[model samples]
Each structure stands twice: as C-alpha cells, then as structure tokens.
Target: MVAVRIAKETGLAIDRVTFKSSLTLDKATLKAVPAGQCVTRVTLEATVYGDVTEEQVTELGEKVHVCCPVAAIFRHLPGCEFEPVWTLAKAE
Candidate 1:
C-alpha cells in the first residue's frame, strides 16, 4: 500500500491529487515457497498529481518513498522483499 501527501506549504488550496498505476508484477515468488516460508514480494505502481509543479511532484514522491510505513516495515522485517520498476514517458 502507498500513500501520498499533497498539502500545500504555501497556503494554497490544492485539494486534488491523482494516483495511477501503469505496471504490476507478472508473478510473485512467494507462491513457490513453502507455506511456512516467510519470503514474499509486494509490487505496486502509482502516480500523484495536484496543482503543483513537476519539481514538487518529484519531491513529494521521493519523500513518500522514503517515509512510507509499509516500506519501513518491510525493510526492518526479515524475508520480505519488494521490486520496483519505473517507466517514463517521453515528453511531447
């Protein structure tokens, strides 16, 4: 699960944000492991948008990646894994 924060520090009313996913994992390795095997992978993709510049979006995304609770949980726990891949569209 991914959560995005888009509150304006400049006192602007940027109340709208968008999240999108363009890619997902084809298969998860957890299924092959024994039922007791703790190893697992959780995959996801998301995009966020609001009344903000590209730079702001990038910063927010970076912060979200750094501060996500699920990410932190997986990092501290043993045998859990995550593989993230990103695709960028060409600018027109």
Candidate 2:
C-alpha cells in the first residue's frame, strides 16, 4: 500500500509525496501467495491550490491507473483487488 499527497499552489506545484507497500499472508497460506508478490492498494492524496476541476483530476487518475505497472499486474490476479484512492483539495 502507498499513499501520496500533493500540495500544489494555484499553479499546481506538487509539494509532498508519501508512499508505502507491504505483503502479508496467513502463515501456512504463505505458499499460496508468496511474499512480495501482491499489491493491496495505492492511495493518492492531492491538494491543489488552483482552478483545477474534479473531472480533470479524476480523468488523469483513471489514465494513470490503467497504465500503472503495479495496478496492471494486480489486475490479472485471481483475488487481487486494485484500487486508487485520490483526495483532491482545491484552493480558492
């Protein structure tokens, strides 16, 4: 799992980014799913200080999710669920 935060001014300048990823299993079930072989989810928190619209951010995120390598990998998995959480804060 990874979390990213984007604090941008009216000009949309990213300020900070935080991310993390890990793997877990049910002890004996470790054989079914090897360590470091799964990606739970990725979350992106962005705060924009501009006139950016929600549609724009959502569209961009959709595009990224489709091409994101990690997401694509999990897409083909049997029980892997891929989700991208986006939090956009628009400045006045």
Candidate 3:
C-alpha cells in the first residue's frame, strides 16, 4: 500500500488538497516458480488560493516526504525494491 499526505500551510479560502493512486500486480519468476509483486503509486496535489512561492512549496514537500510513513518503511526494508518518481505542476 502507498500513502500520500498533503497539507496547506498557507492559503486563502480556496485551498484544496487531493490525492491520487493506482495499484498493479506483476508476475515474475525468481528461480522457477511464479511470484507475484504488487506495485502501488501515489501522487499528492494541492492548490492554494493565494500566491504561493516555489521555495515554500518545495520546503513543505520536502517535509512531507521526510515524515511520510511509507517512505520510512521503504527505507527501512533492506531487500525490498521499488521505483519512485515525483512531479509538481501549477494549477491551470
């Protein structure tokens, strides 16, 4: 399972937070038998009504990334492997 947390530290009355995620299963053979692997990807999005600086958003995102439980768990596991990617876009 993948988890995402979003927080709006500064914003006007239109501040909003959203999360998106998807899961997929893949089959692979390690030695001879078949093994199933579950892959989950999560994305977090936020919109602030007022003007928000890029530096502030980057700082907040870094804080959230550091404190995220899922990221901690993935880091603690020694043999687990995963692919992680992150992106940020301004609202239109």
Candidate 4:
C-alpha cells in the first residue's frame, strides 16, 4: 500500500509489486537496548512494469521512504537502515 501510494503520487503506473523482508534481533542486546535491535535493516526491491520513467521511479523511491509510516517509525532508531531499490521492467 505504501508503494502504491507513492507510485500514485509520482504518477507512475505499476504492475505487481513484490518484496522480501529480513529482520534481525539480538537476545542479549534486547535486554541491553543496544543500537536498536542490535543493528537492523529492511531492504525493499520493487519490481515495476508499465511506461514509467526513470525520473518517476526515482521520485517514487524518494517518496516511499519519506512517506511510509513504518519507515518513519524506524528512522529514529540507531543502526536501522531502509534500503529501497526500484527496478524497471526490461523491454521485450
């Protein structure tokens, strides 16, 4: 939904959007409160189709991070990185 909103904001028509998520937690650090989950990162690879420009894709990338609530929540945590990658479909 976050991606859809940003894509709409950027006016980039999109096809299926898929993502993979991996979360890391440290048991010792959970007790110690060390650097937010003992260091964590969420990398989102967005595969898109349709007649979207690179500039639009870039805008979508920027907007999603800035507007995403989940991202906003994690923005303040230490060692938390949100890596977003946008991939345009290949011409066939």
Candidate 5:
C-alpha cells in the first residue's frame, strides 16, 4: 500500500507490487522453551513491476522502509532482524 502510494505520488509508473516473506524463529522458541524472542529474523522480497530503473527501485525500497509501520515495529524489537530486498520487473 505504501509503495503504491509513493509510486503514485512520485509518478514512477508503477503498475503493481508483489512480495514474498520468509521468517526465522529462535530454536528455543520452536522447542517450546519460551526463552527467547519468537521471531529471530525476517526476509521480505519486494518486486515492483512497471517502467522503473534499479536506482528508482532502490530509492523506493528505502522510502518504504522509512514509511512502513510494520517494518518499524520489527526494527525496534530486541534480537529481531529485518531484511528487505527490493527489485524491479518489466510490466507484463
């Protein structure tokens, strides 16, 4: 949502945005030990489709990170790591 809004605001010609998520949790937590943060790491791959350049995608990704509230929450949590990967694709 944030990406689309930014694209519209900036006139980036973005047609759509898609993402995939992968998460890792502490082994102890998985074992039901309850001794550490449940989520240890998060990886999000965001693909923006439309007429865009690598620099544009990179800039968009940075802006999204700064604007995304959910990402902010994960960033503030202790022992939790968040990684966001942004890329561009030709609009079909």
Candidate 6:
C-alpha cells in the first residue's frame, strides 16, 4: 500500500504491513449531513513493520494525508472527521 511505497522510497526496509479502517456515516440520510459532507468520520490504522523509528512511523502517518489522493479528498470534506493511527514494529 501507500506505506509500503513510501518505505521503499525512504529505505525503511519494511517486511510487512497491515491496515484497518472504519468509515462512519449517517445511515438514514446516506448523504451529506449539511449538504457537502460526504463522510462523517474516517478512522485509519496502519501497523508497519521494519527497522524504522517511531518518528519515521509518525512521518508516514502524516505523509499519507499528503500523498494519498483519496485521503486528501476525505480531508477536505466539509464536515468530515479524519483520524489516522500508526503503529510501528520490528521486522520479523
């Protein structure tokens, strides 16, 4: 995924990566709450494995918002709430 690409580019030597995400939206309307908001809340969690530092993981988390086109779109939604969680682990 995006993290893998970034790690390869930055020489992070990643062995594996896992991700979990959740999207919350109004069920009844199934549409924008205030006529511009598409998603209400988005939670994305990434567990990265490599010989990387916590700072590097944090950087990856921040950079995803800038590099991922879909994430960028979600970030701009009028009333959307974005939450990104990053976890780092040693490569096995």
After TM-score superposition, what is the CA distance of residue 46 in candidate 4 from its true location, in Å? 1.8
Stretches of model 2 off by over 4 angstroms after superposition? 1-28, 36-51, 90-92
The lDDT, on a scale of 0 to 1, for candidate 3 is 0.42
Global lDDT for candidate 5? Answer: 0.87
**lDDT of every model, 2 decimals:** 0.46, 0.46, 0.42, 0.70, 0.87, 0.78
lDDT of 4 by residue, 22-75 (tens): 656655677787556675766667766768877777777677778778767667
Query: Candidate 6 on 1-92: residue-level lDDT in tens?
Result: 77778878878777877888898886766653554454688998888887778898898878776888878777888778988888896545
Native RMSD of candidate 4 (Å): 2.9
Question: How good is model 2 by TM-score?
Answer: 0.50
Clashes of each: 0, 0, 0, 0, 0, 0
For all predictions, the C-alpha RMSD in Å is: 5.6, 6.0, 5.9, 2.9, 2.3, 2.8
- Please report the TM-score between candidate 3 and the true structure: 0.43
Model 3 misplacement above 4 A: 1-14, 23-25, 29-50, 77-92
* Model with the higher lDDT, candidate 5 or 6: 5
- Model 5: pairs clashing at backbone N, Cα or C within 3 Å: none
Local accuracy of candidate 1 as per-residue lDDT tens digits, 13-86: 23344443222222464467554344455444443333555555556555556777855654554564654322
Q: What TM-score goes with each of the models? A: 0.44, 0.50, 0.43, 0.69, 0.87, 0.79
Candidate 1: list runs displaced more than 4 Å: 1-14, 18-42, 75-92
Q: Which structure is stronger by TM-score: 4 or 6?
A: 6
Top candidate, metric TM-score: 5
lDDT per residue (tens digit) for residues 1-92 in model 3:
11223443333122433444443333343444433223322234433332445565555556655777866654444444433343334667
**Where does candidate 1 have its weakest 10-residue lDDT segment?**
83-92
Q: Report how far residue 24 has shifted in candidate 4, in Å.
A: 4.5
> Regarding TM-score, does 1 or 3 come out ahead?
1
Could you tell me the lDDT of residue 33 within candidate 2?
68
Q: Enumerate residue pairs that collide in model 4.
A: none
